[model samples]
Target: MSTVAIFLMIAGVFFFTTATIGLLRFPDCYTRMHAAGKGDTLGALLLLLGLALYNLNDGFSLAALLVSLKILSIAVFIFVANPTASHAIAKAAIDAGVRPWTRKGGKP
Candidate 1:
């Protein structure tokens, strides 16, 4: 694998790990979802891009093109869906009167 591909894979793994930690450690549902949605999308995109590049090292082929296209599709889907889901969740939470965390007295 090329150095760049390796770097991408490593960075993707790091982002994914940090996202998992954030999901486990964050104090609020919205915060956790934010971390999960954004970080996972970025990490998955990086990992997929790295894999596609590695595959392309064997020279241009139908399989390589297809793999890259699939990766791009996944990225696009996440780009469209993650924010929409986050917005829906935030709206539902607001409608239900869910309160944000504050440093003051921790009440509602």
Candidate 2:
């Protein structure tokens, strides 16, 4: 269980790192948001799952179960909210007539 917890946490860290790199290197607002939102949500979910597992392994009590459920709930919230928030931002940008960067023209 501990090994699984560690693996999940490490995977989450890797995803978070990838998200950070994407945020730094992505060409435009939409692309950056895509990288960040997708990677971050998965990374966060994995981390929370790892923590929940660790908690359960540490103690076999009702409190541990509650904490695991809480973590799961938070993960679910992020799963729903991240995409919605990203969509809102994209919609706002579109409504404002924000243009995408093109490699052959203007500032890309």
Candidate 3:
């Protein structure tokens, strides 16, 4: 259990690092959002899950279960909310006429 929790936390950090790289390297707004939103959401959820598991390592009790449940609930909320927010941002950008980057004329 402790090992699993440690692994999950490490995985979450790895994902967050990748997301940072993607945010820096992606060509355009939509692509950046896709990278950031997907990676960040997954990373955060994993971290939260790891935390819950770590808490549970003390042994399962009613109070411990509730704490884990609360942590999981937060993860769930973030999982649902982030993608929706990202979609909304992308839509707004499209509606306002932000154009996607294309490689054609970007050739130098």
Candidate 4:
């Protein structure tokens, strides 16, 4: 159980780091939004899962249950909001005629 918790934490950190790098390096709004939105949702979920598991280590208790519930609520909120925001951004960009990035020498 402890091993699993540790793995989740490590994985969460790795995902978050990748997300940050992608946000910084990706060209154009769509690709950057993809990196940030998806990565953030997954990273947050993994981190919250790890936390929930750690909290459960001491056996089921009221406080532990509350903590788990709070984490779950946060994860659910992220799940709902992240995609919605991403879609809105994409739509707005398209309406504004924002161009996507392409390979050098590629035709637009």
lDDT tens readout by residue for model 2, 1-108: 989999999999999999999999998998999999899999999999999898888768998899899999999999999989989999999899989878885683
The runs of at least 3 residues in candidate 4 whose Cα sits more than 4 Å from the true structure, single-residue gaps closed, are none
lDDT of 4 by residue, 30-79 (tens): 89999998888888888888887877888889988899889888878888
- Over 1-59, each residue of candidate 3 has an lDDT whose tens digit, in order, gives 99999999999999999999999999999999999999999999999999999999999
Prediction 3 TM-score vs. true: 0.94
TM-score on alpha carbons, each prediction:
0.83, 0.93, 0.94, 0.90
Model 2, position 103: C-alpha lDDT score: 82
Give lDDT per model, in order.
Answer: 0.82, 0.92, 0.95, 0.88
Candidate order by TM-score, highest to lowest? 3, 2, 4, 1
lDDT of 1 at 57: 78
Give per-candidate clash totals.
0, 0, 0, 0
Residue 57 in model 1: shift from native, Å?
1.7
The deviation in Å at residue 13 for candidate 4 is 0.9
| Model 2 lDDT, residue 54, Cα | 84
